[model samples]
Target chain A: MTERIVVSPGDLLGDGVFETLHLRPSGPWLLEEHLARLVRSSSILEMPEPPVDRIRSAISDLSVSSGALRVIYTRSGVLNVSVSTIPATVLRERREGVRVLTADLGFTVRKPPPWSLSAAKSLSYASNFAARRWAARQGADDVVWLSTEGYVLEAPTASVVWLDGGVLCTVPPEEAGILPGITAEHLLSLAGPAGLGAAQRMITGAELSRAGAIWLTSSLRGLAEVVELDGVARDRSPWTPRLLDLLGF
Target chain B: MTERIVVSPGDLLGDGVFETLHLRPSGPWLLEEHLARLVRSSSILEMPEPPVDRIRSAISDLSVSSGALRVIYTRSGVLNVSVSTIPATVLRERREGVRVLTADLGFTVRKPPPWSLSAAKSLSYASNFAARRWAARQGADDVVWLSTEGYVLEAPTASVVWLDGGVLCTVPPEEAGILPGITAEHLLSLAGPAGLGAAQRMITGAELSRAGAIWLTSSLRGLAEVVELDGVARDRSPWTPRLLDLLGF
Candidate 1:
């Protein structure tokens, strides 16, 4: 059942932080990392510390074995918890990979505003959704945002992860001033165990196209391989299955 | 009584557009302009056309004589109409003017992305609120965002307006890619009747500080003069009360 939440109109102004986690039969995957990121996001918004104990208790009471679990905390200290079925698109993209369009985001990675919350998982996500919608209109499944200098930054709702030889690389969150994707970080940590090296580096859009493999990493989608970039079809990579299996997708 | 709204988790994601209008004893101020902007905002987000007649009907059903009336429309076709008391700070600022800090918004006026919603009143307002919070922390009441090239843009929640020589001037919404301020435009339309010239011009932050007078124009606040900018005090402009009276505030 779709859950409904009661909120003040002020809450609708997008002054809040949120976390979406993949709920497994055992429990929420990477609950600790997600919670830690939630705290960091709140700090970036200058919000008061969230009530961690209350949040844990709320999660513990959930009866759903698997789905998407969302926790939202508004600037006015209002908290909401809800569970929803995963969208069919998420599953399809994970299985068949995604066609991504590369577009200039018109942002400079080096010069975010002093009060920039670009690194925060703030509720103000209209731009992100708009970018994906634009991709869909262009006959692509998703979009990868590039900085003004042509550096591949990240995806609309995910982090850009690429494989170069035996090295697994993703953009450095702090340097790029983007939300540190929990799923991407976790996947990179497993690279060494999978006989690969992990690295964080910035690459131009043209250079990114030459990588061994490209994937957009997020919580629910796990890793959606970039099967086609900017209308250019790419050969399937062997690492796709291995990386997905290592992440237990 | 404070009103509560029931919304889905998707509604809190900030993928929506909204309008806030001043409710007076007679009726909502600039109702048509506000509704027009709402439609423009929805278009920018690529949402289906909003049910305008329904919104008008809902506003007519409002019982309160004076307050802040808000209409929110999410990308998922959810529409919410609510009324609430304006914050005391808005009144205080309107009465005594505002102390504003100038900061670079890290945006280039000329390079907005294809899917940019900067001109729309989207629900992605966390950055706007964050900028205001940063100003308050710095002992100011508001902030004026400057483009990366140092040209004056707009305030977090208002449009920048000023008196240059004998002309009333504002930033061109189309050229600057900022939200079209209904209040500012209406005020400028009255400039001729008030025996003043009106214009849309671009100026640098330094030039803005040297204007004869500066103000932030919005619905509820009407006009909040910038009495102090970047910790530099300026004498109160005699035009403040005259403009306020002209606007019926």
Candidate 2:
């Protein structure tokens, strides 16, 4: 059943922050990290700290074995928690990989605005959705946004991770001025046990294209390998399943 | 009484478009223009055409003589019309003038992304709100964004207009890729009758400071003269009230 919430018209203005989590039979994966990011996002928006305990209670009340769980907190102090079945497209992207396109975002990371919410997982996601739609129109499954300087920033909804030699690398969130990816960071944390070096580096889109393998990482999709970029197809990387298993997907 | 709308969680993602109008005793001011822009904005977001007849009926049903009227349409096809008391701050700004700050938006208008919604008044207004908060922190009433190239763009919630000798000017919406301001456009259309020539020109932040007068124009605010720019005070221009009246504020 679709869940609905009563909200003031002001609450619909995208003046809020949100977190999406992968709900598993075990529990919501990376709950602490997602919650912490939610607080950080709210601070960036100058909103009051979210009620974490209430969010936890709302999550606890859900009886679904596994699904997608979302927690939203608006500037007007409206908090909503809802659970829905994961979309089949997300699962398909995880298993079959995604064809990706690269586009200049026409913005620089060097000097972001003082009130920049780039680091926040704010609810103003229209542009993100539009960019993905643009990708679909271009016959690709996703897009990686590059700063005007040609540096790879991230995908609209995911973090860009690439294998460079024996190292696994992703953009440093602080340096890129983007939302920190919980899933990508967690995967990097476990890289050592998987016999790969993990690092955060600013790589240009051209440089990214030449990497051994590339993937877009997020909560629901886990990680979708980039099988094609800018119309060029790439061979499947041997580490896809290994890393997926390493992250317990 | 506070108005409430029942919405699904997805409706809050700022994946929507909206227009604000000055409600008047005569009727909702500039109703047709606003509804037309709403359609254009929805097209930009790739949403289906808004139910114009429904919105018209909603506006006609409002009995409030005067207030701020907002029409919102989400990607999920939710249409909402709400009327609320105009904030005292808005009235104060219109009458007392506003101190403005100019800040680099860290983006170029030269080539906005293909999926750019910069020209649309999308519901994703977190950054716009944040910019104003940043201005307040700087002891200013509002802010005007500058493209990375230093060209003045628009205020967070309004358009920048200025007087250059006997001519009135504003940034061309198409060239600057910012949301076109209905209030500013209407005022410009009547400029000839007000004994002023009007033109849309790209002006830099530095150059704008030398203009005879400047104001931020929006639907509800009408026109708020810039009392100060970047902490430098300017003498009140006699055109402030004249332009406000010309726009039928």
Candidate 3:
């Protein structure tokens, strides 16, 4: 499907917005939430918000019950939607969990530049992809980024979340100055009813490793439980499947 | 021409490389120099060097002169060369001059990140363009960026050069960890024979503003003389046109 979208040669500069959804037999899961984020993302880049109707029209077809869904919006004024095979790495992580490492990203902690689209899911995702590739090369399944100040940030392609005793937690977007993770937000919203509490707070990487059960959450992967952090291995927590079912995965 | 390319939609993500040459009646001015920069840029993004012959074939009916020539290369595997009308403001600056402001960009003096592409002219150019847009929004013609330690860095899209008495000087790319400015390098090379000394040294913005004449140099604009530093107006120097002509603008 990535090859199917016809576009201009200039569209590949990574100056675009994109959303990845987990396609379920029911439909593109969390479709509205993802679409809303796309619109918000576009606005941050000073791009015109894409009409939601057009997005709906593009993905209205009935087909694959399960796959990875992607919507890309470019500064050159192109919006495209597509579906493809779900990555095997995502499936493996969902099942067996993952080993993770942490590193400082060293970005400006002050106000982002006037044109900063840090909150946008822009297609300029080469660095994100490269970070993941670097993690793979280092024998870790994923990486959790830190600010130069040593405050924990998000994962390259997912949000960092943890079960701090009974309180489920994720970082605050405004304070962290990161793209708000839709899947993590949805999960946090559901925490209260799941007999747990949820909070948004900044934590250091060391604090994260000591949490009850750490996971990287995203639309496609849903949740990849961390079985080993840094180097110490741990047994899988029993809550992984329960949370997936709650999310209707 | 933007509409003519047979590109897949994924091409728009800002994850690419580009070369902007000063197009002249004699074909692209400094074509070899620009191609070498393109190759250096490709290595920064971990992409394969594109086939130069393919790029050469695209420049067939080379009929245009005195324009801005840009060649875009995307990780999605598309090589696009385009020639367009240069911005009138650029020409105006060549004829007149520019009011310049300096600000600290907060980049550390330490080595760039392992994955940093700061030295490359990769297509993740939204920030570079945004900085210029920011300057325009602030009512200045352009901005000269400074490092976190207050060392004078390059401009958003050009190299910063100043005349200290009879010596012509600019920041050394290797020492400053910046994208080497092709125009500035060429100008500095000819400075000695022209009876002006040439040097590369790290200087503060205050030191630059105190210099006799200040200018921003790039391939397209050649040299944009600084008519004002900060809020203080300065007279246009006689060397602006001489240097532009020397570079064959």
Candidate 4:
């Protein structure tokens, strides 16, 4: 990335909202939903609602760049658009299943702040990045944070999706105080009609481990299965390719 | 404040440490301690140890500007320096006291992650700035955060300092898992020989209200008395200015 973007000093304080979309050769996937969530996230920070039309125009003006399109909206009334090659590690994790760790998130979901942006993609992501970094230092690929009361939350960069007896389950973000994963939510919506059961439940990490299969879902990589969770090797499920194909990964 | 201070795109992320010192006409006050703490804070973030000789030369090259001197160190090995005037509200609060609100910080300080940057002057300060913004919405000058167990931790931008029975007390940073307040530590030390006692104690918001006097200490303002906390009036103690004088505020 070039250091050519001139932003106000306040932008560096992380008082903003952002969206990281899987930029394809044609266009950004799930563009509308990402834009909607960006506005919602900005509102939680008490920022003015961004101009969606201008954003769409900017998207239409783009060329054939299959990379990440990051839209950062700051409190200083700045909108930044930067592109870079899709992170190599994300691709590596997608090819080879990731090793994972788990820890308590230490926050209640029900009593989240009135202006909570948990369901929105916000820019205050240092803690999330730090968690992943911590996991890497511990020889794991990522971490799944549970609530202080032992309920599963989400991962550093992806949503938790696991197979609990034939039912594809993910925690209800509204009840879990987690960012609603667009890809995972879209996948779950399709599961029911495809002769597969879908459900949202408050689960414990141990309960997750007991499941037949577990996967981390996100936009870029689609779904990266947990090959070895905390050094305990697990067999990869045959559902991986099917789910990725359904999501057009 | 100059646009020429070119920074990498990654610098926009708040993975860094920072220090703001009171630049006097004489020199940078408490320069050595500030520099040491900056290094300590960087280590917590796993950043490289800054070159002390380079920093010392930077200070020597600075003009005699009596304002706030800020040093920012990022994990990506970037160090930046800038000078800016303190906000008018800071001086206003110092002279006329301030109204502060109490709120849950939503983090268990006691069990913070081993690599947590709680004691560091980090740049991932969106939450800190957000807390102060929350206070503004609640008609107060600032906020005092409490741990999940209701123990008073520290303010978003300053440290909590209270006088109980002529004894000055501030939270123990290591025990409380919060940042060590340099200004508060300095004042507490100066209070001892000035016929006042000093100590570190674990306190709660309710426990804090019963104190003889309350103050929020920082580098620039020195110390701002809390005449009203959560809307209740507090006694105006004469020790405020005396304590300030001892610290050359």
Native contacts recovered, in order, as a fraction for each? 0.83, 0.94, 0.42, 0.27
Give the C-alpha lDDT of model 2: 0.94
Q: Compared with the real two-chain complex, what DockQ does model 2 have?
A: 0.94
Error of 4 at B94 (Å): 0.7
Off by over 4 Å in 4: A1-3, A113-120, B1-4
Error of 3 at A208 (Å): 2.4
CA shift of B42, model 2, Å: 0.3
Over B136-200, each residue of candidate 2 has an lDDT whose tens digit, in order, gives: 99999999999999999999999999999999999999999999999888889999998999999
Candidates ranked by TM-score: 2, 1, 4, 3
- lDDT per residue (tens digit) for residues A173-207 in model 2: 99999889999999999899999999999999989
Point to the candidate with the largest lDDT: 2
lDDT of 4 at B222: 88
lDDT of 4 by residue, A1-249 (tens): 363556644566666777888888768988888898888777767778987888887777766467888777777776666667888888887778789988766666546644355666666666777788899999999999977677889997899999987899999988888888887888899897666899998898889889888999888978899998878999988888888888777
Give the poorly placed runs of model 1, Cα more than 4 Å off. Answer: none
TM-score of each: 0.97, 0.99, 0.92, 0.94
Once superposed on the true structure, which residue ranges of model 3 sit more than 4 Å away at CA?
A62-65, A232-235, B1-3, B60-66
Error of 2 at A3 (Å): 1.0
Q: List the residue pairs that clash in candidate 2.
A: none
Q: Which lDDT value does model 2 have at B232? A: 97
Chain B TM-score for the candidates in order: 0.98, 0.99, 0.95, 0.96
Q: What range of 10 consecutive residues in model 2 chain A has the weakest lDDT sum?
A: A240-249
